[model samples]
Target: MNEPTLPTLHWTRRALLATGTAGALSLLLPPVAAAAPEEMDAAIREMFGNGTIREGRVSVKLPPIAENGNSVAIDISVESPMTEDNHVRRIGIFSPRNPIATIAEFHLGPAAGLAQVSTRVRLAGTQSLRVIAEMNDGSLWSGKASTYVTLAACVIG
Candidate 1:
């Protein structure tokens, strides 16, 4: 029996147009760079422009060493009365090594009692997680926790 040979396929204009468009579109977009320390500082300055940042009554509770960089559990507590007079208004989390310096930003009011929040965040590698809490009196408080990651979650091998 004789076997039939198939002809090689050629890409039509329709098939190639998508790839060309995609490439051209990608070139027009800005490149995504990992968050740098300078960008972190810029983000901080933008967040609390000229606001004095105090250190106290803010605590970050997370594992000193994380086995996995993905979805590390964190608990943040700010000693605030949650009263209409004095309360924590906002909490911004900064991850220096992540793709974005600001990992998360939270807005709270006096109705949010306890001024404590728990969330899981992705870590790129071993880095310090900084938290800034904005109080009702326009005072900003900061705290930091160091984490050692065994595996990276944000970076691709």
Candidate 2:
């Protein structure tokens, strides 16, 4: 049996110093901040200008307690007919406590069959999740649900 030879390793002081400087710079940089209410409101208003967000018409389905914060199941359904005259235009998902409050935006057309969607998202912690549905007629509907996360993700202890 032949014995394997270990490869020789070379260390450069300049390379090590450059790597350490880059690491220190990263720590000094400002952390990514979460979306504020004003920003979120502006985004919503931009989507639905001068439109009121009424509840009841839209429904949000999520567990009261999330076992895993990495992948939380979410479902949103709007009470609307998938017709040429009346249909859902888009669906926006928001998490108040996430680094970016706006999680996802799904555009829908009449061919979608129904105004319903299901997906999984990462939650930073226990926070309120909001779903806004925009109709073809420029009407906005909203649904909200609170989720308690047992283990939060994307945050350092």
Using lDDT as the measure, which candidate wins?
1
For candidate 1, lDDT tens digit of each residue in 9-28?
Answer: 33456568888998889768
TM-score of 1: 0.76
Predicted structure with the largest TM-score when compared to the true one:
1
lDDT of 2 by residue, 1-70 (tens): 4543532322465677889999889768754445566666777676667677887678998899998888
Query: What's the TM-score of each model vs. the native?
Result: 0.76, 0.74
Per-residue error (Å), model 1, residue 81: 0.7
Q: What is the C-alpha lDDT of each candidate?
A: 0.84, 0.81
Residue 141 C-alpha lDDT in model 1:
95
Task: List where candidate 2 sits over 4 angstroms from the true fold.
Answer: 1-38
Off by over 4 Å in 1: 1-34
Number of colliding residue pairs in each model: 0, 0
